[model samples]
Target: MTMEANELRVSESVPVDTGQRRGTRPMAPDDVAAVGRLFNRIFRRHDQASDDDLGRYLQTVFFGSPHYSPELGSVVHENGANGIDSAILSVPMAFMVNGRPTMARLLCAFMADGKAGAVGAARLARTMRAARQDMCFSDNASPVSADHWVAGGGIVLPIQSLEWQRSFLPLTAAAILAGRHFPIARSRVLVGVLRPIDRALRRLRPSMRPKTEGECRSEAARVEEFLQCASAMLERFAIRPAWSPAEFDWLVRVASMNRNLGTLQCRKVVLPDGRTIGAFLYFGKQDAAATVLNLVFEEGRERDVAAAMFAQLDAEGYAVAVGMAQPFLMNAISRQRWLSFRHRGYFCMVTRHADLKEAAERNDIYIGGLASETWSRLLTDF
Candidate 1:
């Protein structure tokens, strides 16, 4: 059979003599539309997106990629009627494991219709685990999904699951947080009322004020510069993304497309000697909280780079800054009393390799940012 024919055959439901149909199969390109519809119904109900838009996003993220692998493709659960009821997306990635190239998969957008039940979700999860990959992981699993993952023998990274935030304008940040539930809190009049109080609070607390030390400086960072800094800084870890220049560039471009998070900002921190020590990527708008996508720095210069990044955000008038609690930056983050942390989502992994599991447990692997699915527009855009 031709490759296309064979793929269709595999993705189609198989019937036994008893007339029972198979439950799961490898996801095909044709399944994108149905999967997109299911995703919109489950996760994007508040702001439903068009099937065409979702299909384009899924194609770009899952099918149209330099790292796409047939052997480790995504999986979907099929109902008795041969309709897609659940989907577990797997984005294939290349990684360097102690200097050797290995294949990894980032699981994202695991969605199921109510008809699928827990059994269908579990079946799809099993299909994903059966794929040929060194490791399978996710940092965006919901609480319900996390429970299923742990039940299925996955381990959760506690520290990595927390999100840390530093409020430069505490009252303004509080108002914004409240706005999520009560729209009135987001009114300009209320924000205007809180501005003076936040300013006074910043004056009273030295830690709350943005660091203006001139020891390090930040400038707009290009993808090439970010790749260079990230490659060097991540070498300390035993397992890291082994993206080529082209692949790394593609990843950054895709990440920059998520405008829902806000405008993408890429900056590099340097010293007077023109030496680049760190680079940070985030999305922000004036007078709003910025969501940091990735922050990488030289081994001993975390504090310096972090301070510079915060100062840059303050200058841009962001009310607050937040990001994943990367293990390497915990000390620097703890030193700042103004920063607070809360449980965001579970970071879970399923791997049979002892070394990989050990590295993850020890927090010695690069698991977030480009290594995970947070960059996908599926999570940000409806």
Candidate 2:
């Protein structure tokens, strides 16, 4: 039942050193649970997340409608034990430039099963050899086992740009925005925390009477007003395409995922004018002092609407607020109270390649595009 030399076709599409002893075997569907558990132990343990939530997250990323490819993934075990000790998952993405096609492997995740089998040096070497030619990658905030990745010969470098981390507890969005040295060009909209608001609403529900029908109508009108403002902004510049409800739903779901990981919460921002112009997803623990998340606005409305929204959130008492700031969003996040979050908050370990690095840098700007070699192992069985 052993893999024979003839059957083991060394993938030439990518360059990797196969001299290492352990070889990659494609992950099987049955291996998904074990893979999930491994990830849960490494990343979700501290979050105190329920098994159901973790399972749901895994299902969405791995078993949902669009299943990840097991062929591009592998589970590395010292010997042929059915239970996986380590795993690597990857997906191929074609980036077109100047009418030319460039193929890159998006590493999903890599995980080791609590050091049970203890990933061997040979396993790492072989996997790296296998992935080298294909431009294998990993993300900055991945929960992958870093030790194994380094053993596999992957070097951590400033691929694409970098992952920046900001602590909402220590500062306010106003401070970050106001920092003169912060990259105004890169700044975007501010996402404010609604933690206090959500908790207060719940606590005061019994004592506080519900708003009257007229008041309810007026509130609904505000949501519509914001929506109108957002729509108008989109029409003016035509920068970002109009957002569909489906996209908002996806945003909401992603927000929930973040909440499980940390203290962030998300809410759709409704303006007094009766429109839902934008959404702010908060990140931070409720018990913590601040919340930080992204505020996405309809492209052209960044200046007028997003600004007003942040001001409102600030007045409402939610602390630390921050937003993605690229040149387009500079005007919104650049302010006296907003402090600039430091860059290099996250990093990706990738095979050294000039062109691939450039693509990764651009992908860093968007959600779900960061490539990390650790992703390969974590998502193999997905």
Per residue, candidate 1 scores C-alpha lDDT tens digits across 1-382 of 0012233234444555656556777788988878887787888764254567778878777775686756566777776665777878777778887777777778877887776545667666665442223677788788887887677666789988988988889889889767756869968899989988888887787678777445899999866777788888989998888888867777777777787667777899999999999999888866877888788889899999988888888888888888889888888777765788988789887765678778878889876777776667776556
The digit string of per-residue lDDT tens for model 2 on 68-177 reads 34434443443333345566544444333222333444455555555564543235335553235434544443324344455554544332223222222232333333
Model 2 C-alpha lDDT versus the unseen true structure: 0.40
Give all TM-scores, in the order shown. Answer: 0.88, 0.49
lDDT of each: 0.76, 0.40
Candidate 1 at residue 172, lDDT?
94
Instruction: Tell me how many residue pairs clash in candidate 2.
Output: 67
Model 2 TM-score, all chains together:
0.49
RMSD of each: 4.0, 11.8
